[model samples]
Target: MSKSSHRDPLSDTQLRVKALESVLLEKGVVKQETLDAIIDNYENKVGPHIGASVVAKAWTDPDFKSRLLENASDTLAEMGLSGIEGTHVEVKENTAELHNMVVCTLCSCYPWTLLGLPPTWYKSTPYRARAVRDPRGILAEFGVKMSENVEVRVWDSNAEIRYLVLPIRPAGSEGLGEDELAELVTRDSMIGTAVVEMN
Candidate 1:
């Protein structure tokens, strides 16, 4: 078969990365099981769970909440959450009057350590543009409706920094423990795209 007639399974750059990974694996510099473990962690244990843990701690601990609001990245590190994409995190608290949202105008720079990979819509150009131009409309599209009196704040994520929304604790959740509170937190809430459901 002609080379041109068959599409390559991997892109040239992707193939190069794979080749490098293979070499490292063969040399025992990187174990296959370790690689699989890392993937499994990101696919399951990491992502919103980490963010939710942080949020729940803040909701349940006043001092920790103050520390998180004052210096988020350091606080995250204390919790064993840090990565290239999450080297810096800034928490934006959602209040009765102000609602926060995040967008990456340049690219899909995100808190991968806390949210796994960026969602497709979040990485799209339309989201980047529309979020800055019409945040309320975007929120509405996500089924997040707020009164006109509420203000919408849009944050831009870049290589240097990322944003996480500290959603308001539901009124009925006051008796909940940190773990229970964490259960109430959601990926969308961490991304400022939706509110954490109380129930």
Candidate 2:
């Protein structure tokens, strides 16, 4: 077989990305070590679990919850969770009457260290527009039917700051431990797309 036939197939976009990466590496614009570190950070070191831990702690500890609400950056730093994309973080709490959701109207400026990579929908133009324009509709589509009496607040994340939603603890979960509570926290809940359910 010829070299072309032997080569693995790659999509046009993938090939372009690989070509650009090769050119950058050849030009010394980026170091292999840096690239490896970034991949490793996203693949292993970072994820929604980090944010879930903080949420669990907040759920179990009143003081921690207060600190998280009052100063999320400082509180996250205390847990050694501070880094790029997390320098300026804000935590919004969900209560009986108040509901909060976060969206990046400009771009997907998310808390990468806490939430890993942003979801494809989060970066889409439709989501960016609808999140601010019709948050209740979006929530309803996600199966969250908010009562008419409940207030809905939509937060726009930007380059300067990112928002994390502190979803209300599920009923019958009061007896759960921190780790168990963390298990209950989902990435969508933190993004305010879905509420945490015990089941």
Candidate 3:
């Protein structure tokens, strides 16, 4: 497979982020190490866990789930996971009959507050165009096989509003606690590309 667009061809958002980081470094607002740590934290530690926790709570708590479904931007504040340019968020459900996929056709507009940074593939033009045109095909490429009856729903992310997919919890997970459930939620699942594996 070819390398990510980062090295071969940088996306606009990537360039902007780099420019901002450079300005901040020049002003001494943050050290290079600090910036690197923050990126590492988002890429590995904190970001995706926030979204996973939301999904896990939705799985366990019906009231929060309802509130989340109704207004994620506000409901997320209750969990202290709001802010960071997340003024609007739309939560979509992936059920037995419906499947959801997220893409940003223009830029890498995503729920950065909850999901951290978008993956390199998410910023690719090919992925952006292909996701909306053939969501099931993209899902299959991601190893998400679905039955023919499942209707695929693709949501194009933008700067003002972003989408998060609440994937269907696997069977036999009824006994799992909130933390255990959160552990099962992956970044791709919330992106609607893959389902949460029970194991």
Query: What TM-score does each of the candidates earn?
Result: 0.83, 0.91, 0.80
Tens digits of per-residue lDDT, candidate 1, 67-103, equal 9999999988988888868888899999999988888
How far off is residue 121 in model 2, in Å? 1.2
In terms of lDDT, which candidate is strongest?
2
Predictions ranked by lDDT, top down?
2, 1, 3
Q: Give the least accurate 10-residue stretch of model 2, judged by summed lDDT.
A: 3-12
Where in model 2 is the C-alpha error above 4 Å? 1-11
Q: After superposition, how far is residue 128 of candidate 1 from its true place, in Å?
A: 1.9
Cα deviation of 142, candidate 2, in Å = 0.5
lDDT of 3 at 79: 69
Q: What TM-score does model 3 achieve against the real structure?
A: 0.80
Query: Could you tally the backbone clashes for each prediction?
Result: 0, 0, 0
Instruction: Give all candidates' CA lDDT scores.
Output: 0.88, 0.91, 0.87
Winner on TM-score (1 vs 3): 1
* Candidate 3, lDDT over the whole model: 0.87
Which runs in model 3 stand beyond 4 Å of their true positions?
1-45
